[model samples]
Target: MEMKTIYFAGGCFWCMVKPFDSFDGIESVKSGYMGGHIENPTYEQVKTGTTDHLEVVEIIYDDAVFSFDKLLEIFFAQIDPTDAGGQYMDRGTQYRTAVFYTDETQKMKTVNYIESIQDRFDKPIVTEIRPAEVFYLAEDEHQDFYKRNPERYKQEQIDRENYIKTQKNLS
Candidate 1:
């Protein structure tokens, strides 16, 4: 039961949790702040985009059951990897999409996965692949947000799906 962790910034940490959580072998998905210059940054601080922090999720998964590559596939599918600003209705530097790799293996996997899917989309992927930095767990209220607020989470999923459908039409 070897466990590994990855950090992802895919706009609205709340929205990022559900897709990964739905899969088996995902031990936990914690909403948090990563890549920030300051310590203990609040949501509002990161939201202002001055903290250089991105709203992110720290995902703990069992690698033996689900390979990191599979996770990357799921992650990429759930996000607008080509969107540099944000995902769906969200916008701002703090909402940018990124994969914070914990090691060289993860880095290689992320880069390779991104390249493999290039032909599937019309635009180039702009999602950042960077070294993992300090990850500060968000407030308890933010953790497992989808589980806590199922209706709101469902609506977000609907909105994202509709947005993606609209985006596909334009391309």
Candidate 2:
């Protein structure tokens, strides 16, 4: 009854999925592209940084089960907002971190949330807080990438790759 949605572009979409899915009230987490000018852009065009599209996840949740603030907290905990250029090993506009607010309230909440956590870091938080744009769902192959690519997922787990690197670089 109290459903809401939010968009987060945090580096690799593959690694971003599981974090939000773990929380309650998260009805769905869809990996897609947003904040771009093109229509229904392809993964190749976005991945190659040829388009303005950002790789983001669209999260639908029930506010009664989990507050948006809690979502922001978990999101900030996972990403290095201080990184201006990009996040972790992924270096490109598509890999950049951002919060695409669907409404004025979401925008205000995001700004306030950023202010609350600003003091925690020495450098400025470069995580862009902007209005939500058109979302283009990625190819089916990209959906639940970690689950689909078990061998790569297993290797990633064995190496502790993305998460470890992201945490280490966070200020």
Which candidate achieves the best lDDT against the true structure? Answer: 1
Per-candidate TM equals 0.92, 0.89
Q: What does candidate 1's lDDT look like per residue over 1-171, in tens digits?
A: 989999999899998888888778889899999997999999879989899899999999999987899888878877888888878888888999999998899999899888988999888999999999999999999988899999988998899888889877997
What lDDT does model 1 reach? Answer: 0.89
**What are the per-residue Cα lDDT tens digits for candidate 2 across 63-137?**
889889999998888788988766666789898999999888889999999998899998999999989988888
Q: Assess candidate 2 and give its lDDT.
A: 0.86
What is the TM-score (0 to 1) of candidate 1? 0.92
Off by over 4 Å in 1: 165-171
The lowest-lDDT stretch of 10 consecutive residues in candidate 2 is 156-165
User: Which pairs of residues have clashing backbones in candidate 2?
Assistant: none
| Each prediction's whole-model lDDT (CA) | 0.89, 0.86
